[model samples]
Target chain A: MAEKPKAFGERYMVKPGKSFRLADCDPRAANGFSDKDAAKADTVRDAAAIDALQDKLYAEGKRALLVILQGIDCSGKDGTVRAVFNHCGPIGVKVQPFKAPTADELAQDYLWRVHHACPPRGFIGIFNRSHYEDVLVVKVRGYAPPEAIEKRYDEINAFEKMLSDNGTKILKFMLNISKDEQAERLTERIEIPEKRWKFNPSDLEDRALWNDYMKAYEVALTRCSTHHAPWYVIPADRNWVRNAAISRIVRETLEEMNPKYPEPKGWDPKTVKVV
Target chain B: MAEKPKAFGERYMVKPGKSFRLADCDPRAANGFSDKDAAKADTVRDAAAIDALQDKLYAEGKRALLVILQGIDCSGKDGTVRAVFNHCGPIGVKVQPFKAPTADELAQDYLWRVHHACPPRGFIGIFNRSHYEDVLVVKVRGYAPPEAIEKRYDEINAFEKMLSDNGTKILKFMLNISKDEQAERLTERIEIPEKRWKFNPSDLEDRALWNDYMKAYEVALTRCSTHHAPWYVIPADRNWVRNAAISRIVRETLEEMNPKYPEPKGWDPKTVKVV
Candidate 1:
C-alpha cells in the first residue's frame, strides 16, 4: 500500500472507505512536534494568517467554510474555537452550537436544522456539535432503530457532498482525548471548587459509555471520510499541539482555496464621481 | 459636609440626583497606580479570585450579579469582558450584547426584554449595552416623546429596585472615553483591513452626535445612579486601568456577597455504605 500521509493535516485526515480504527491512533502524537511553546507561537502566527484569509473570504463573498467540531465530553471543543479563531473578528465568524433538538427542530427531518445552521457565503460557521450526533449519540443511546441509524452514514455523506458541490468547504474534527485524559479532566472539574459549575453527575454516566462512544466514533470517522468532505481525527490530549495542528491545516486550506475580492464590472474607482 | 469617599470604588461612583458631567472626569486617572503591567497582573490575579467567588455563587444558587456595560462605540466593552472574565469558566458568566432591538423586542415595554435577559441565580450576566439605551439613545434620537422619555428614568429605577428586592445585584459602568480617543479607535478600525468588517459607515453617523450623547449620558448617570443600581464612570481610555478598576470592584462586590456552598441536608459521609 502507498505510505500514509503524515503531516499536520494529511496525517489526521481519515482515508476514504478503508478499514480504519480510531484506537490505532495515539492521542499523544504531536505530529513530529515536541516543543509546546514553539507550537503556541506558531499557532498565534497562523491565527493572524487566518485573519487575513478570513478578510479575503469576506471580501470575495462567494464561498463559505463550515468547521464541524465533534467530540466526546471534556474534549476541549470550545477552547479550540477561542484559541484558533481569537484573532478573527466576531462578525466574520459565527459559532452555532448544536444542542439537543428543540420542538421546532424535532418537527422536521434530522438534517433540516443542520441545513439552516450552515455558514452563509463569506462567513465561517463552527458547529460545536453537529449532524453527526444522529449517528454517534443517537445510535449509542438507541434514540433510533439500529437500521435507521445505520443509514445515516450514507445520508451524512450525501449531505456533506451537497454542501461541497455548493460553495461550502467543510472540515470536520473529532477532538480525540484518551479515556484516562478524560478521567483527569473530570476529576479536576470535581475536585476544584472553581470548576464545579462545569461538572455534571450525568457526565459520569457518559464516561461509563466510553468504549461504546469510541466504537461509534470509529465507525463514523471511517464511513464518512470522503473527497467532498473529510473528517480529521485530531489528537487533543495536549491543547497546544491540537491548536497548532488544526490552525496549520485551516490556514493551509484557505491558502489553497485562494479567494479574492471581486472588482465591479467594467468600472474604475477614478472614473466614479461623488455628488 | 461629609468626607468624599475616594477609594477606587467610590471615586468613580456616580452620586444619585447630583449634577454630573462626564467631561469633568479625566479618562487618564489610574487611581494612583502608575504601572500598567502591574495592573494587568493584578487584574488576572483577581480574575482567579472572581472565579472562586463564582464557584460559591453557583453552589449557593440563590443570587445573581448583573454587570451593565454601556459606552460609546470603540470604548472597549468587549475587550473589558475578555480581560476581566477570561479566567472565569464560560458556564459561570454569560455575556448578552443588546444590539438594536429586534421587531419582537420593540413591540414590548423596553424593560421586558432586558428583564428576560437578566442573569439567573448563580450566573454572572454581563450586558454589553443595556436598557439604559432607552434613556441614552431614545432621548438623544427623539425615539420617544419628550414627556415619555422623561418618565423612563423613574420607571427604570423602580424596575431595578424590584430586581434588587428579588435576588439580583446590579453594577453599571459607563466606559468613559474622550472624543480624541474615540477618533483614534475609529480610524484604526477603518485603516486595518482585517478589522474593516467592524467598521460601519453608519458608525460615523453616531459619532456626529457626540455632544448630544455626552449630555444624555450626564442626565441618565445622575438620575439613575440609585442605591439599587449605581453607575460608575470608569476612565476607559487606558485599557489596562479600565480592566484593573473594574476587576477590583467586581472582586470586591463578590467578596461582599459571600456566597457559600450548601452542605447536603441530612447526608453525612461517615454512614454511607459503598455498593
Candidate 2:
C-alpha cells in the first residue's frame, strides 16, 4: 500500500478507552511544525481553508460542526476562535460560552444546556467552555459528589454519541498549557494595568487546585473520548502551535466531510443567459 | 450654567419611568455621523477607546461594566459584540450569551443564572441576549404563565438595582431593527445556505408574535431603564449604524466609569531606578 501524507493532529489525538495522561503532551513542544513562524504560516493557511470549507458546509446545510474547547483558565480557547474561525460569516458561526449553570440549567439534567447549544446542521458551533466543566470544575470544587461527578463521564460520552448520530460532527480540543505558562498569563493580568480587571483573586483559588483539576481532566479525557467524538490535547503554551494544530485538524475533518455546495436546479450556468 | 457638550448617546437613551417606543428611532438613519464610512471610522475609534478604558477598568478591579444586548432574533446582538468589543483581550472582556433556560435554570429564580455570569470587579462583560428574555420571549411565546411573567419586569429592575449598587455599571442596548428589516434578515437566513443553521424554523413562530414581543420589549425597556443602569434603543437595521451607535454608547459609558490604575506602593517608576 502507498504511504499517505502524514497528518499533523494524529500524534496529539487522545485514543478513546486508552489510559490518557495530561503530562504526556509537552505544551511547549511544536509537534508537527518546525518553527513558530512556520507554525503561524500553516495556521493562516489552514484557517483560510477552514473558512472556505465552512462556506461550502454552510451552503450544504445538512450537517453541522461542533467544536468543544475545554481547558483550564488560560488555555487559549478564545484565541483559537479568533485565529482559526473568525472569518466564517457571523451568521454561520455561533459561539456558546458556558459558565456556572443557571438555576434553570441545573434544574434539568446536566446536558440540558449542552443540548440547546449544539450547532444546528451546517453551522460551526464553538463551545468556549462546555459540559465537560461539569466534570473538571465540579470535581475539583466539590460542586458534585464524587460518585455523581464520576458518572458524568459516561453520560457525556453517550450524549456526544447521540449528537454524532444526529448529523453533528464533533471535535473536542483540550488546550494543554503548561503550569508555568498559566502562571505567566495570570501574572501578566495582575501586573499590566489594562489587564488588571481580568485578574480575579479567585483565580489563585483554582491555581491552588491545579493538581486536582489536572487529575479530573485526565479522567474525563480518558473515560469519555469516544470513536464518534474523540478528544485531542493540543500543546497550547505556544499560541501559534495551538492554532496551527487545531486548524489543521479542523480543515482535515471538514475535507473528510467533503461538504458539497448544493446544485442549482435544472442545469449548468453556461446554458443560462444573464439578464 | 453653560450647556455641556451634547452626549452622542443621550438621544437614544430610554428615559427612566417614561414610555419607550421602539419606533422612535430610525434604524437606517446615520444619526450623528455623516455617512456609513464615517460611522464605521467612529466605531473603530470608539472600539479603540473602549479597549483602553477596559484595560484601566480591569486594573482598577473595583467595579465592573456589564453591557446587555437584547433584541428579537436577527436584530444584530452577535454582530454588535463582534464590532464593538472584539478587539478587547478575551481574558479582559468576557461575553456571556444567555440562551433558553435549561431545566436546572428553570428550577431556580431566573436571576440565578444571570447573576452568576456577572463580570467581577474591573472586567467589561457583554451579555448577548439576557435576563430580559423572561419578559420578552417568555411573555410573547407563553414560555411562562402570564401572571408570573407580568411581575418579572419589576423583579428584573430590582435585581439590576442590586447589581448597580454593588458596583457593576450597566448599559443595556435594545437593538431596534425594523420589522421589514427583520423579515429581510430572516429571508436571507432561509435563502442563504450558510445562514440557514442560525435560523431556527421556530423563529417563524416568534415572527408570528412580533407585536407581542414589541410590547414586551417596550415595557422592559421603559420600566428597567433606571438612573443607575439605562437602556438605549439603538437603530439597528443598518449594520454600520448599529455598531457605531453601540460603540459610542459603550465608550462613553466606560469613560464615565473613569477606572484608574492603582498607585504603585512605596515606589514610582521615575523615583525608583532599576538596579
For each candidate, report its DockQ versus the true two-chain complex.
Answer: 0.10, 0.07
Tens-digit lDDT track of model 1 for B1-275: 12234356888899876878887889888775699899999998998899789878977899999999999999999788877875663556766778889999999998999999898898888898999999988888899999988999899999999998888988999999988898888777665555555555656767889899999999999999987788999999999999999999899888878898775444333332211
Q: Can you give the lDDT of residue A156 in candidate 2?
A: 89
Chain B TM-scores across candidates: 0.96, 0.93
Positional deviation of residue B275's Cα in model 1 after best superposition, in angstroms: 13
Task: Give lDDT tens digits, candidate 1, residues A47-136.
Answer: 889878987898888999998899998899978877787567354676677878999998999999999979889887788899999888
> What does candidate 2's lDDT look like per residue over B1-275, in tens digits?
11122288888888877766776768777677658898899888998898788768866779999999989889998788778876563546767779888999989998999999898897888898999998888877787888898788788888888998899988899898888899888877666665655656667778888888888888888888887778888888899989998898888778877889875544333432211
Docking class of 2: incorrect
- Stretches > 4 Å off in candidate 2: A1-6, A11-82, A85-238, A254-275, B1-6, B19-21, B48-62, B89-125, B137-150, B198-216, B259-275
How well is each residue in A110-212 modelled by candidate 2, as lDDT tens digits? 8899898898887888899999999988888988889998788888888988898888988999999988899888767656655554445567789888899
| lDDT, residue B76, model 2 | 92
TM-score, cand. 1 vs. native: 0.77
What's the lDDT for residue B158 in model 2?
88
